[model samples]
Target: MPLVHIDLIEGRNDSQIKGLVEDVTNAIVKNTGAPAEHVHIVLNEMKKDRYSVSGKLKSEEDQ
Candidate 1:
């Protein structure tokens, strides 16, 4: 069994997210020779306040 974890800022619509997941799964299947059914993909979305950069939260960066 193969697992994939992806983290991103929370905002994409369902269509976009679905496409992302599908593409990731396909890539995994193609590169690792893992069956589509056996490949696992996980997506984790966080709010701007939960993500930080350069010692500042994403929400604070725009200020």
Candidate 2:
């Protein structure tokens, strides 16, 4: 079994997130020979204000 964790901002639509999971699962299956049923993908969405970069919150203009 292979587990993949993806974290990003919390604004993606359902279709986009579904496609992302499909693509990432495909990649894992292709590269590691993992079975589709054995591949697990977890997506974590965070609010912009909860994320930070360069000592500034992601909601800030600098992000």
Top of the candidates by TM-score = 2
TM, every model: 0.89, 0.91
lDDT of each: 0.92, 0.93
What's the CA error at residue 4 for candidate 1, in Å?
Answer: 0.4
Off by over 4 Å in 2: none
**Over the stretch 1-63, how does candidate 1's per-residue lDDT look in tens digits?**
889899999989999999998998899899999899998888899999999988889998678
Residue 41, candidate 1: C-alpha displacement in angstroms: 1.0
lDDT of 2 at 27: 97
The CA lDDT at 18 in model 2 is 94
Best by lDDT: 2
